[model samples]
Target chain A: MVADSLVAVTIRSLVLIIVLLTVFAYLMLFERKFLGWFHLRLGPNRTGPWGLAQPIADGVKMIFKEDIIPRDADRFIFKLAPVISLFVAFAAFAVIPVGPPLKIGNWTVPLSIADPNAGVLVLLAFTSLGVYGIALGGWASQSKYSLLGALRSTAQMISYELTMGMSLVGVILLAGSLRLSDIVTAQESLWFIVRQPVGFILFFISVVAEVNRVPFDLPEAETELVAGYHTEYSGMRFAMFAIAEYVNMITVSSLVTLLYLGGWRGPAFLPPVVWFLLKVSFFVFLFIWMRATLPRLRYDRLMAFGWKVMLPVAFLNLVATAAWVAFR
Target chain B: MATRSPEYFTHQGYEVLETLDGDRMILSVGPHHPSTHGVLRLILELEGETVVRCTPEIGFLHTGIEKTAENLTWQQAITVIDRMDYLSPLSNNLGYVLAVEKLLGLEVPPRAVTVRLLLAELMRIASHLVWLGTTGLDLGVQSMIMYAFDLREGILDMFEEVSGARMNPSYFRVGGLAADLTPEFERMLRDWLQRFPKRYEELRALMEENPIFLDRVRGVGAISQEDAIAWGLTGPNLRATGVSYDVRKAFPYMGYETYDFEVPVGTAGDTYDRYMVRVLEMWESYKLVQQALERLPDGPWQTDDRKIVRPPKHEVRESMEQLIHHFKIVSYGFDVPAGEVYVPIESPRGEFGVYLVSNGTNKPWRVRVRPPSFYNVMAIPKMLEGNLIADLVSVVATVDPVFGEVDR
Candidate 1:
């Protein structure tokens, strides 16, 4: 019986990793294609029909490129940074269920790899760990731009992570559980977004900042720091950092899906997995849309916004949710 | 390279540094950076993210254009002069040719004067469009570049129709223009003139009220009017300080006195003010183009002097005297009376002046350029010190120094 469950878990884990990695590759193409349309230009249309194979072409090129270690760089840490990033990114997905459980003759198989009781805490912990990759990558590079980028990432992550945590407290209060599955189940009647609208907005903003995307993408601001923390990374090492970023983006999108958008729940016409994917894709599209339209915030201003505005607002939301939950 | 301490950087007379407050890191930004506006290098002393000292190191794009101009004849020299301030090549051509005409005491016909005025205004709009787009790019508004460049392309098409070259046309000649303005040029100009305002409004909507953009630029890299004047800033950089010292209005070249337009000025003298002045300047240039097009006159394309202006191809073919005159003008070129003249005109950047000394020969004895970007670039330290590294990018964009002109 242990052997049977072990086989099922292994298969589920393998499928999750493969599917996630594939989605990360395609997400890059989708971003570029969407940005191209926004800018009134043709995107990647040369490699395959309508640029379908562009990501594969990009991956092949990344694999073949030369990997350089800066002469003064901390070689061990520099080598280990991207691995940490990609590993943490993929590992965070272990608790996020894609669909409902399936019964096979005598046993039941949960769709997720692990359904931890403290799943929400695990998600927050993993997302916070993402900064280490960028910070270490910057520090280990021995480049000034990288050092500054690392410094910015450290400060920015600390400021926004507080708001992110506080924002999630409101949802946790409403759902009355730390398990993400329980939170999704609580939203089966009505999505958490409707109950905690302020929390939803705060979470969305903080997640955008957490992912190091535009308007908060100071660590790798090309206009200022060239390529920022990963300026010295090349070949597969560079590809690893990029993969980590996109995968984190997908993971957070799924979190938003599972926590607030009614994960794997939709009309009867479509299957649960398809519904989950569609909702996650919408959040992903919204992220890309923000990149297209908005300019980056200044470093000092971003910190101020995170502390003075986002933190206070998130705290207020948590208090409001707590009061309502206790009274009801 | 030698390792220098923070005190060493401080003791080197980086005038911008008020006091060395803490641990400093020296960072070299560009000669190859994405946003230094081409080959401009800045040695910055940083305290965390704040810039403590900024020393602009130029000459990286030095092509020795002024020296190169000496080897060519006065008529042949226009080609090299167009290379300086390459973004506004027509303005460079106009300045050089007008200086030579001043030396010869020649009078450009009404038609040539009108055409020169029209093209120069169009060039101003085109150059400012480039500044607008790249500055937007530097500030992280990614889509402004595409919209701005699309608008500039239409003006470049008009230039191509007139001079058969898009970038450095060298269309202005010693006594007049190189050729008559084609009907194709007029048609394209009319189409562009009608479409430019809507396109410009679209660009303005993206920037003018954006909170992120405003936060990045406002009160950042501000210089007072007295300081701007002391630093020898001109053009939009000076006007941003509320000086209202436009050379077109003050000196009045190419019959600019007849065109009624307001010189836009700003009060704050910060990066945002500089941006606003240039934005308004584009619309003013559009106004000038509309007025010039309405008053377009038809007559002789050049001054009727066979010694200076080359004869028409048909006349040169039909008559031996005209052919000899054309051959002599093309080969030996026209000689200016032994005199030196400096003609200052309002280029797209600032007051672009051409100083020419002719020793009664076909070639100029000396050709010196008073490039506006040279003066504008000197004020970098004044604006960059005490700002953050990101503000350095914004300040550099607002200054709008074309390194081709800065290091000419």
Candidate 2:
């Protein structure tokens, strides 16, 4: 009951958003540094000591830059699109449990902003809503490059969203609950990655595609589409789209931790939150590694791979998991 | 503007831009784009993502290099020539110097010829490294450029030691080299040679071993051998289509015939083949450098004729006759015979030819360049037929059109 209190919810949300945004900012720095290491170059060391203050410098710079809406753009939608993107990205974290509920004296505080029975569904729905932000932003910008990018993003996200949901069905069936906490709890003995390895791989690929990360980052393929969906965006508005992207990466990494990895369950030496952070950081590092290693998939080939390979495999995994659960 | 008739749209060549008629999207793909290489624009008409019509528009980087060369003395014209193919300045210098040398009926010493051969091959490797790096970037392997540029820095360091400049060295003179290679140049070249093969292997494996890279490049932006020849494509672009028409083999300049190296050709004219041809070409260039370095003889680097070669600084200060020769060469430049000569050489891009017209005057009557990239770029529309917009980036990158050469 204390967990569901409105005051508790508001305080938790305010804390979560601020923490998430800060994490998002620092994660950008981490990616740049890590990618720089991969590139055999020192990245972003000029801003502060070892570039620790780079994200803050970048934030201040973005805030000061001029925000220009193109003369031919749909002004209202162009202004509204990044807001939609940032909102959807942050909103997905509400139902994603970071660690077990905190107990302070007689008061119990849920770590997540909200705890719904169908938390995984809520997260999926929020992520699916992210396509609207990209689609509308591209269409409203009045630029051909943006429109093509938007179109590619629309098709890509829609195709991969199905496989993503289907992959999660195996985890949902194994846990016999839609609550993310329950899914994490079910993995107390054995992580789902051991049982549903195929589903985990499928989820990983689809998540990469869903977030429009490289190999699947056609929506913002800089060389091809010239900055893609954000071709016309500038200043703080452009920063919002970028911030939304990093936040989405964090959110998805957390989801993967909660579902496939053992969430906050680790050795008793460290705290549960630290274990959760470690797990999520591993996925983030993996994503960056993928970005450094791979080339962008062709648009047609991506679609074909999604339909012909990923969808069928994910569907079979779901059916087999359902049958296994029934037999057990 | 919205009320314009269909006939008006067709009349103004805005047929593809007519939004009301059909769903063709016209994308102006450069002059300011990241992947256009530099100031090259492609007016691409798209039905969905496929390029329906691609009209390449150039001259954005036209610096009037040919006309500018006409104003300079024959020997001084090498500066502007170096700017044409900015990626391979030494190759341009070689082409122009060889052309002017032919016009003067002057002979360069054997040592200068060997040094010129060595520098040319090193430059070929450097130019191909840029092509490979940029193609990697366009295809979405972002780290490849960093690896490539890191390796290329060693070559540029060697150039700086030899000529006191990096990109456009203008090291070649009409009769010989501006100066002999420094001992430091040889040390750096040996150091680079030691490290280049391992890094090159890494780069090649990074591209060829990845399945996604293969999928993106294989069978994309393909042109037939006939089409390649018809469009006047040369260098790696032509070699990728299974043609073995390297000018180094057909017409040896700077004793290219003496170098023991193979010309690598590809069977498929797709982006991958173009990529592989250039990758192998870099290795062959490496071999040529090694051979030239081994056979480098010790002798004079310029012609003994004071009428063409500048007299030594000490000799000019001491001897009155040498002073006049140096003064005339420095101030007015030596005059060439009233005849024209066209000399072609195997530049990294292709057959970089120089056509020079001397009018028995201090300045050349005409200085024309046959830049290889102009012909290579002409085949872009042919290569891009029925390919997607993403393929356009890869094709343009693999084609390696330096707009400085295309527009000059």
Candidate 3:
């Protein structure tokens, strides 16, 4: 039984990496094209038909470009920073179930690579660790812009992570289980989004900040800090950071889908993965839309908004969830 | 192009170069930053995200255009001045040519004068459209850049029809115009007049009251009226302080004395007010264009005197005397009387003034340009004091300093 489960785990690990890497590339292409429509301009239509190969072109270009390290940089940490970021970005997805278990022959295999009992703990732990990559990268580069960007990014992460984790507690209380599959299963009757709308909203805003997307995108603020923490990184190193960001975006969107939006739950017309994909795509589109519409929030104001506003709203949501669960 | 600056330091020591004050960081925002608008460099003293002091370093784009102007003849100098404030090239053309005309004591016909007014207003709208688009981009609204520039494209097409070039159209001559307007130029402008009001309303609806944009701009880069004046701020930057000091109102040119238009002024001199002033100015410019189009009279496009303007190409081809006059005007170039004149015009930015000194030869003895961006950018440090780094960007955006003009 152990050997069979181990084989199943190996297959799942390989599949997740391949699938997520592909999704990250396509998500970038989707964003550029969608943002172009918002701007009433054509975006990268010349690479292949309808610019379908634009991401591939971007990858090739980034890979071939020269990677330069500053003379004053810590060479060991400078090389290690992106690796840690890319690893954590991919690792955060290990706990989230992609779909229901598959039954083939005599063995039943779960879609998740690691179905830990405390899945929320695992995800949050990984999310918190993701900042070290940015901070270390900035500190190592010895460039002033990177250090500022790194400082802003690290502070922003700490501020928003509280709201992000607290927002999920209301959903967790309702589900009555720490496992992500149970979170999805509890929403079979009615998605948590309908009952916990306030939680979802707070969580969504925090996720935008946590992922360093627009409005909360001050850390990598191209206008202020050049390319931010990744200013000194180039070639495949920069590409790694880029991919890590997109993967984090996807991971959060799916977590939102699984935890609140009823992951893989839909009518008889669509398959489970398709339904999950559709839900995640909706959040991804919303992220890109926010980028097109809003301006970056001031750093101090962003901190104030997170602590004073979002944290209290999340706490109120948790209390409301507990009361409803107790009475019902 | 790299702008070379001497190394910056608070103090000099072996350990000091490595780290100073330990808590405070000195960050250089640009000669290469995305939001500096051009090659404007700000050496910022940062206490965390809050900017303690911002010292702006200009002259990255200085090409000595005024020095270059002294070498060109009175007629040939329009080409050089247009490249100064590239966004509002025609306004530069108008200021320079008006200076020359004032020196020569030349009279422009109603047709030429009216056409100049119409083109100048169009240039105003075009310049503001670029400012609106780019400012939105700096503040992180990605779609506004494309939408705003779309309107600017229509204005450029109109420019191409009127002048041979789209950008640096040296169409305005010393006395009048290089050539007459196209037969269908009036129709294209009429279409724009009918269509642009709705588009302007749409642009306002998109961003003016947006909560995110409001949060970024409202009361963020506040500069008082007293501070604005003390800093020598003029144009919309000054007008946003509720100072009604438009050059057109104070010193009318191109028969601006007769044109009925209101100068839009603001109460609180902040980024939002500056944005409102520019948008309202576009509306006012559109109104001015409509008025100029309706009142355009039937007359010669250039001055009647052969010494001031070249004869019509057909006349030059057919008549020997006309040919001689055209050759003399085109080759030798007409001389301005020995005198000095300073003509100030209400350029899109603010007070775009040109000072001219003629020595009675074909070329100008000395030319000096008082570019509005030069004065406006000088007031940046005043606005950015004690504000956060983000507000620093918004103030720069509000100033709309074109480094080309600032450095030139």
Candidate 4:
């Protein structure tokens, strides 16, 4: 019985990591293709049939490329930074279930790595820890551009995390559970986005910043800091940081899916995972579209927007949500 | 006199023991920065992300073109000057040629002047397209760089057909144009003129009123009219400051006085206003190019003088005087009888002036360029002060200082 449970958990964990890594690579391809269409130019199509193998080709190139470290870099921290980044990014997905729980005769298991009771807290904690990698990478680089990028990223992370937390509190108040599965379960009658439009918007924008995407991408503002915190990272080390970013994007999109878009929930005929994928893909596409359209926010204005605008709106939303839930 | 804050505790007047205020850090922003336009370094005194002092450090791209100009013949010098403001090579060519024309007291035929005007305006649009695209990239509109490049490629195709080189056409000669326009040039121009109005609208819609773009640009990097004038800001940058100083209006050249086009001006000298002024100026240039193409006169493409303009091919075959004139002009080059001339022309950037001194020789004794980007870049420190480091990118983009010209 113990052996059966252990095998089930190992198999599930392996499947989740491999599937997520594959998705991360394909998401990049999708972004490039989408951005190319937006710019009215051809995106990469040379690697394989329809450039389906472009990600593999890129991965090979990243692996073969010589890893470089700045001569004056803090070697220990510099080496650890990307490990930390990729680690936390993948760790956040442990609790994110892609489908409803499955039953195999007498044994029943949830389709997740670990469905912790405090899943939302775990997601928040891990997502926030991802910034430490960037901060440490920037500090370890021993360069001014990296330093500035790290500083901007840390400040932006701290600011937006407040708004992100407050915005989620509205959902927590309504759903009455910290567990992500519970939140998704609570949305059986209706998606949370319908009841919490303002919260959805606040969550979307704050998470955009948290994920270091454009319009909120001041931390790695290529024009200003060269490549920001990862300016000094090279080869697979750099690839790790990129992979971490994509994984975070996936994680955030899924979180949004579960919390607001009724994850794995749909009309009959289509499977639960399919529905989950479609919703998450839509969000990922929205992120890519935004990168194609919007200009980055200036650092001070981004901070001002986060604190002055998003935070206050989030607080008001929380109060309104509490009152409505109390009456119900 | 002290740069550090007064509240900091100091030991022995030199060493700081403890600090009461926030620590200030000096950041060096690039000789190889993505958005400095070229090799320009900035030393910034920063209080966290806010810049307290910004000092521009140039001269990394210094190639001594002015010194090299003294050795080259009057005609050969135009090719060298092509690289000064290489994005608008025709404007540099126009300025240098007009200066020599002033010294030689030569009359450029009406046809040549009209063609020059058409090409120069096209160059303005092309340069502005580049500015718009790169500025969008600087502010993190990821797709705009590709779009801008795509549009500019159309204009470059026209340039290549006329001069066989897209960037440094060097198509304008000392007395007139290097070559006559081919039938293909007209078709290219017609195609561009037809296609670009829609493209112009598309580019404008991409960011003009976009709230995020506006938030990044509007009311950022503002310069007062008085300060702008003091810094000698010119072209769209000068116009953005509400000064309304356009060289085309102040010192008319190439029959610009007759062209029916309004100089676009801005009320507030912010980055957004600067961007708007350039956009409006591109439209005005479009109108000018359209008018010039329609009213292009048919006559001699060069001045009818044997001294400055090259002799006709048939004449060189038949007449000894003509053969001698062609050979001398080809080898020793035509002399500009001793004189000093300064011709300030309206380049897309601003006032591009050529100061030339002649010693009655085939080569110029002195050739100095008054490139507008130089003065425009010098005003950056003022705009950058008290703004975040992120704002520096936009401010530099607004200044539009091409290092090739700034450090020329």
Candidate 5:
């Protein structure tokens, strides 16, 4: 009976994984379409009605693309890097609660794949591992730009990761729980964004830097470092890196919604999943809006900001939150 | 033996030369770089990250525009200027036409003057948007490009309403505008003017105080005011160095004096100062456009000179004389007196001057353009020396030289 239950749990987890991956693929298309609207241009409407098939086309193209490894590159590390990046990025979703539990006939299943007591810690570990892929990819390429980019990625990730981790301490303290679902429940009265605007801002900026998005994207500053760490990467291997980045964008956005905006909490009419998706979409749109509006920061400035500005702000927020929890 | 103690190396035909190991390294930046602002090449010698020497190689976008101008008549030459600094073609058109208008000795009506001022300011904002976006992109800010382009589209729409094209409007004729401003165009302009300042503030919030942006730009590519004047750098690039020199203020043309606006000057003349100057200038341009719109006088859009301008469209249908004049002007074009005139207009890049020798013919004998970007680009080497490889983009973006103008 125990073996049967274990098999059933594994099967249910596999189903959830498949569903999330499908959502991730469509989310990319959704971003492209929305960003296009924001820019007053049509994005991708050719493949199907409103470009529904565009992502599929992209996937097929990526699959058929010629995979090339640089001659002087460390073959083993280069091959392993993208896989590690993609695995870690996708694996983080397992801890995120997409919606409330659903019951059908005799079976009841949670929206998330797993709900561990240390869910937040597991997500952080996965994110930390993602940087290893970037560092390894840069080091393995053995090119100057790539090396510089990898070095930047290492420094940026280490610096911003601290702030990112620290910023979340406030959320953890408020919820008094590490599980994402439990945190969402705690936010039923009011969202963390209202109480901790500074932390939210810090978290948002650090994540943007961590993902190497615009303004903080020194690791892949195209004009200066010529694609930075990924200068030599090509074909589907490059596509995997690209996909992982978009996935991380989605993951971070979802996390922001859950932590600050009050996860899956909206007016009575909409379903819980719909509210979750709506909040996630809002954050995703913000990311695109920011990418389209601001200029990139210089490498020194980016490093300085991560160390000096974001770190201090995050620490202050953490202290304030701990004090508030104690006093309350 | 008589070789007398074998004289030192110098007397033995071996010359001693001094070598400095720490001399600046030579690096060629680009002909196809992302931040050269469109196909500009800069040869840089660096003492580590500081630029020791800079040499700008242009002519990539040169289509022999000056030579091409000589073949075309006064009116046809306007099209040629449109190709130079394609970002602010209206200003180019205004400069060329104003030069020809001076030769013809025609007075543009009040409406024409107002329209010219309005469009010129709009073009300045549009051009600066391109600068802001591309510069931001060069500095690794991907979103600034989108914001720049978004603002630019509204201005382009206004241009298209008046001139029927987004780029290369060629709307400004010799004595006046090609067409009157439509009612819809005016509404769009008023709406945009109101919204632009707020949007600019939003953009500033995103970038200006962000410590990273400040550090990258503040002290990089600093040029002294004396060196800037000596180098013949004009426009915002020159003004960034604390010089209060502006062609519009010093030598007013297109009735720029009538507008109430201030020329923003910077103290440091560094990359950051140049950026601040441009951003501040956009607001000034916004104010100018608003003033021009409010005080715009109603009158004939084009100059009333039958000898120069073609007769009205209504008269052409009935009067044989009008028909003949129109046919002659379109087919052979009008002639100017045998003399040379140099007319300069304040373009977004800088002072765009047109020197034309008419030779009492339909086509000019020789036409030359004093392009501002050419001079500005020459200052790159001086700017880059002793700066880091990363600071190269900052310097390039701050200069804001459009290759079309430089090459032309």
Candidate 6:
């Protein structure tokens, strides 16, 4: 019975991975379309009717493109870096609960790949691992801009991670569980966005920094650092890094929806999965909106903001949330 | 011997810690960089991220405009100027035409004066919009570029109605305008003026007070007033250093003294201050354009000088005298007296001056343009000294040098 359950879990995990990967592909299309609308231009419409096949075209192009390795590059590490990046990005989605449990005949599906006791901790660990890919890619390339980008990314991730982790502590304290599914259930009464507005603000900003979005994209600043850590990367390997970024965006948006915006607890007309997706899409829209609207932050100021401003605010929110939960 | 040398050095009170010696790293910053606005290359010497030296290498977009202008008549030179800035083509057209008008000693009617002012101000706003958008994009505010471009398209549409070209208008002539402003152009300008103030507020909300943007640009690339003047920087780049020196205010060319507008100045001559100055300048230009429209006079659009302006199409068919004058002007062009004249105008970039040396011929002996972009680009090396590589984008954007003008 235990072996059968294990097999079932593995299959469920594979299905979730495939679904998430498909969603990540479509999210790029969605962003391009939305940005095009905002700019009063048609985006990516020639690939298919309304550009439905655009992502497929892009994937095929990326696959067939010549994979270039720099002359002085550490070939082994360069090849391994993108894989590490993509692996960590895909792995983080394992703990994310997409919906409530499903029952079919005698078997039960928990709606997640894993409901590990330390799910939040696992997510954080995977995110940290993703940074290694960027750092390694930068270092292995043996280029100045790549090295600078790597240094910036390393410093940014380290500084912002503190605030990001602290910001999540407030949510964990409020939910009183490390599991994402438990956190989603905790939001059934009231969205944490309302109760812990400060935490939500901190988390949102830090995640933006973590994902290296505009205003926090100093590491990959095209003007100064060329294409940053991926300056020397080309072809399918570069595509993997790009896919990892969009996947990371999805992961953060999902986490934000689950923790703050009352995951899967919208009006009763929609199923729990639909509600969860709707919430995640809203956060995703916000992310793209910001990318379209805001400017990038400077490196020193970004560091200062992460350490001096966001860190303190996140810690205070955590302390306040714990106190509020203990009393109320 | 070592002890004796040390004793002498100690008595002299000369202490040497470390000798700075290394090959200065050479970095080519742009011909296709996001911050370059257009294709511009800055060869930088770096000691770490600090720029030790910078030399701007231009000529990437040299269209040989001066030689082209000589082949074309004085009336056709307006077209050549249009390509100089591209963003503020009308202003370029106006500057060139006004210079030729001065040489011809032709009196453009009051209506033409008012119309030229209106178009010039609109061009100013359009140019500033491009600057704001591209600068924001360079600084990582990708949205501002979209917003700025959106706003600029409205202005360009107005240009299209009057000049029939969105970019190279070539609408202004030596005597007056190529064509009168269409009724729809006025209506569009009025509508944009009414709605754009609110949109500016929205842009400000998105970026102005955002702590991240402020911290990135606030004190970075700071130049003192003295240094700004020494470097020969002008326009918003100079005005950012708290200087109230505007050619319009200082010299009062093209009936600018009559216009009611204030030159916005910034105390801190940093990237942020320059950005703010340009933003405020747009509002001022809007005010000037509106006033020009309200006070627009009813008169002939072009000068009455037969030697300069071609005879009307109807008159060319009817009168032999008109036919001869038109034929002479079109085929051979009109000649200026053997003399030289330097006419300076307050362009959106800076003081755009045209120096023409006429040697008793239709074609000019020498046509030298004192382009503002070249000088502005020259100041990059000075501004970038000791600044981090990250701040280079902000600094370069604030300078706002158009490559066509710089290369020319």
- Using TM-score as the measure, the top candidate is 2
Can you tell me which runs of candidate 3 are displaced by over 4 Å? A1-4, B1-22
TM-score of candidate 6 versus the correct structure, residues matched by position: 0.91
Model 2 chain B is weakest, by summed lDDT over 10 consecutive residues, at B1-10
Model 6 chain A, poorest ten-residue lDDT window? Answer: A1-10
Quote the TM-score that chain A achieves in each candidate. Answer: 0.97, 0.99, 0.97, 0.97, 0.94, 0.96
What are the per-model C-alpha RMSD values against the true structure? 2.2, 1.8, 2.8, 3.8, 7.5, 6.0
Return the lDDT, model 1, position A162: 97
Q: Each candidate's fnat, in order?
A: 0.61, 0.73, 0.70, 0.88, 0.59, 0.67
Candidate 6 per-residue C-alpha lDDT over A24-85 given as tens digits, one digit per residue, 9 for 90 to 100: 88999999998887666787899889999999999999999999998889999999999999
Tens-place lDDT digits, model 4, residues A269-319: 999989999999999999999999999888878889999999999999999
* lDDT for each residue of candidate 2 in A217-319, tens digit (9 for 90 to 100): 9999999999999999999999999999999999999999999998999999999999999999999999999888889999999999999999999999999
Segments of candidate 2 deviating more than 4 angstroms: A1-3, B1-21
Clashing pairs for model 6 are A215-A296, A215-A297, A292-B143, A295-B140, A295-B141, A296-B140
Residue-level error in angstroms, candidate 6, position B333: 0.4
Model 1 spans > 4 angstroms off: A1-4, A102-109, B1-22
Winner of 3 and 4 under lDDT? 4
Pick by TM-score: 1 or 4, better one? 1
Best-fitting candidate, measured by lDDT?
2
Candidate 2 chain A lDDT trough over 10 residues, lowest sum: A1-10
Model 4 local distance difference test score = 0.90
Segments in model 4 whose C-alpha atoms lie over 4 Å from true places: A1-4, A103-109, B1-22
Scoring model 5 with DockQ, what do you get?
A: 0.27
Ranking by TM-score: 2, 1, 3, 4, 6, 5
List candidate 6 stretches off by more than 4 Å: A1-6, A170-177, A184-197, A260-269, A317-328, B1-26, B45-49
lDDT of 3 by residue, A125-185 (tens): 9989999999999989998888888999999999999999898999999999999998999
Strongest candidate by DockQ:
2
Comparing 1 and 3 by lDDT, which wins? 1
Worst 10 residues of 4 chain B by lDDT: B8-17
Docking model 5 quality class? acceptable
